[model samples]
Target: MVPTSSSTTDRVETFRLGPFVVPRIWTGLWQLSSNAWGSASVSKIRRGMARHVESGYTAFDMGTINFPSFDHQLIPRTAADHYGSAEIIFGQFKRSLPSPEQIVGATKWCVFKRTIPSRAVVLAAVQERMERMGTTTVDLLQFHWQDYSDQNYLSALRTLKDLKAEGLISAIGLCNFDAIRTDEICTSLGQGVIVSNQVQFSIIDTRPLHGMADVCEKHGVKLLTYGTLAGGFLADKWLDEPEPDLYSGNLTPSQRKYLDMILKAWGNWSLFQSLLHTLRAIGDRHSGLSIANIATRWVLDHPFVGAVIVGARLGVSEHPDDNQKAFGFTLSDRDNEEIEAVLSQSNGRTIITSIGDCGAEYR
Candidate 1:
């Protein structure tokens, strides 16, 4: 049997993005990508999903890029009960769930630069998801981008707006829109459908603070952040280690390139060790929770953030016993000052801004 922890609160916090409400902490499913985390049979995937859903992370974010497997592997197994494993875990979720309103399902729309994804292209993608996952309407459809010059994003959002109007989706969102572009989109759409802006917002990646945070605050839009763990680089594994070689720890080429830039900006292993030391001390104050939880808490307490997305490798791993430590803790003024001092040890020198927000690198 899988060991489990109980949720500390009876009422789940909800953030309003216009007409929609969502849990503040979301579980990103990209780690389940076979290309990234090695193959797990259908049962392993279902077990992982059960762990997350049972552990208070009912919202899941996935995409259409990896193809056939996502539909065949994750979707049908859970919501549809197509897989035998689904029955077992669905029972688990029902047992632990407070009410039927607990679960939220989400996926993406990835069309990189210059690629004008029409209503047809977008619909086809959702159709495949529906057939494989055995669902009719995807709760949220995120527009993922690659090239800025392409600028066809306006039309794509317009098409997504139409889809929402037609009862095909609950909401429309953007994956990597910059501060300015996101403002322009809200202005153009006026009273259409857009609730969240999903992007890379973590302790290590402050690109959102550069102005995106203000933009979201002004627009009344919610932020769904990914990469809080710095692709697992900022974890205990790298505290004393020399920013792992390109071959280190099953990370993707894209992740390696991104982290390499941070190591350079962060003043190498020595400075990073100091940062970890700070986090370790802070964690101790919170009953010895993992530094990972401390890092996530700092972002959660920030303004305009509805939720911080944390990837759970699931079954294979776990956060501290008190996973609620993320919500239970707060960073003080001195904590912020010290964190800032460590981060300033290398700011503006980072290249992550050029790579783009949350999901832009994939494009």
Candidate 2:
């Protein structure tokens, strides 16, 4: 069920991105592409978008990573093709609004193939996104590179910086980039070149705290985090239940991925149950908040985190109202102590070295 909001007050917080101020809780559109998460009609999706805007969740993530292997061999594909009409859908919804500028649409350009990132190639990529979104200027263009061995990603950032200067892009960001590369890009390009880095950061996956946090604090770069809820495993639904069969078709791709992390990398199922119990107790202390809300709050409480990109399955499922509960309350020192008591038992700290840093799974 989607979280319904009737509260008049605007509790969704805002953060600065270049010259624009946007909601710290952004609506992620990644679910639009695959039926593995679930799907809805275009009209219903647009209505869902309207509900989010009405509730002050105006920021959207239209950044779809394009993997060439997924596409058919014969059909020619562009980066926008992988989004499954997300950009087109957002374009229509934004145009329908009286003040479209109030909404922030952040798209991405992910390079998985090995090639030289020439100026022309980068310009074409940006232009393709502009064409699909029906906007002359992109709000934020986040770039991702698959192979770190190939150093062409720097060349790409240089070209994107030029595009930002030319007004084709408002700001440049990084997606799934590690702390070492993030520092290199920012240092080579100078200050203010990189506005944000989108990565996976959650209480269960505390890899960002290892080194990424220090680098961001040093360079004044903000982190746009996802997987904060561990694909919904951190919620109360799985609190007392036994682990699901991985072969079960009921699990979404996100669920399977995160389940592996919980069972193998982070901790055992018994330890996860203990963590859930701890979160439930914390939520109870906070005037009966939900476990999901408490987990999201824990991530948002970090000073280096700019926002948490919560996934919305459009009309299929959402939690806009419940998600807003993450704000309006500060976690007490006692709350953190109780939470850390559970985390101290897990591999949260060492997951960085074992997993090879943030976004290392993809590489």
Instruction: Give the lowest summed-lDDT range of ten residues in model 1.
Output: 66-75
lDDT of all predictions, in order shown? 0.63, 0.85
Report the number of clashing residue pairs per model. Answer: 1, 0
Which parts of model 2 are misplaced by more than 4 Å? 1-9, 63-81
Error in Å for residue 188 of model 1:
0.7
Which ten-residue region of model 2 has the weakest summed lDDT? 66-75
Score residue 8 of candidate 1 by CA lDDT.
Answer: 35
Tens digit of per-residue lDDT, candidate 2, span 1-363:
124364722687888988789888999998887877898999999999988988988889974442211113422323333663788899888888888988889888888778688999999999988888899998898898888999989999999999999999998999989999999999999998899999988989998898899889888899999888888898989989998976588988778777878887788999999999988999999989999999999998999999999989999999888888898887889989988998999988898877778777666
RMSD of each: 6.8, 4.2
**Which stretches of model 1 miss by more than 4 angstroms?**
1-13, 17-20, 63-101, 249-258, 318-322, 348-363
lDDT of predicted model 2? 0.85
Which residue pairs show collisions in model 1? 113-147
Tell me the TM-score of model 2. Answer: 0.93
Question: For model 2, which pairs clash?
Answer: none
